[model samples]
Target: MSAETRVVLRRAAASDAAAAADVWLRSFAAALPTVVRPRSDDEVRDHIRDVVVPLRETWVAEVADRGGMGGIVGLMVLDGDLLSQLYLAPEWRGRGIGDRFVALAKRRSPRGLTLWTFQVNKPAHRFYERHGFVAVEFTDGSANEEREPDVRYVWQP
Candidate 1:
């Protein structure tokens, strides 16, 4: 997993919905095993297909090798000034895919960006912080669907 390996980041299509949802599921389970998911696998895929991909600025990251876009290694969703979601396949975690995605997010939303992450997701907190995001708010497990304590981070640049 060299940082130099090329990654093709492009808008997700309807066909990518299931794969993107798969990345989300794997990343969620790997990053926050204790957190309970409110939706089933099928429901998640359906939501990604119906709502996230079509209605939001969703991007899928794929490895580009031999002139073809390979399997999807990560996915991100951007909603206006909010970086609604950014998830990477478990094995792709520390290989710069997330950094590139965050860079793209910042480029897309130059004004600023805000995102929420579970409080227990320390790796995510550190990753966002390294990308210039600062913790601006924290909330108990009441506001989010996960019912897990969360922290809000904002990047102003």
Candidate 2:
């Protein structure tokens, strides 16, 4: 669908876990070619199905269709004051979906918000920066599963 298509952002349901995880996997692959994922595809899917959707504050941005909510174009997971994850379909990037996700995350954690992203993901850095997130800490990746250098960003009102 084009950027003009109607998009709906809402809390994710059990059935949305699969599509939301797919969006994560695809976005990670397309946007992070240099970094290696710590988990296999099946592992990620299982985690999303068994843990993220059921336990985390997960949301999905889907296209609105005549039939109903269309395919999921974006996924977001907010944990308390942490914006744990926000990913969009590769083709769906630049369509303002990510912007909407960030706005929602901010509203969810109006006090403050924190998130992490790999240092190699420059686009992500720019996006978060544009959303008022400041890189407050940098890690050598030792503390993370991927062992890739990362930056910790924080946003406050």
lDDT of each model, Cα atoms only? 0.91, 0.94
Model 1: what TM-score?
Answer: 0.94
For residues 1-157, could you state the per-residue lDDT of candidate 2 as single tens digits?
Answer: 5555689999999999999999999999999988989899999999999999999999999898765647998999998999999999999999899999999998889999999999999999999999999999999999999999999999999
In model 2, pairs of residues that clash are none
lDDT score, residue 100, model 2?
92
Superposed Cα deviation of residue 99, candidate 2 (Å): 0.6
- Global CA lDDT computed for model 2: 0.94
Maximum-TM-score candidate: 2
lDDT of 1 by residue, 11-100 (tens): 998999888999999989888999999999899989999999999999999887764547888999999999999999998888888888
Model 2: residue 43 alpha-carbon error in angstroms: 0.4
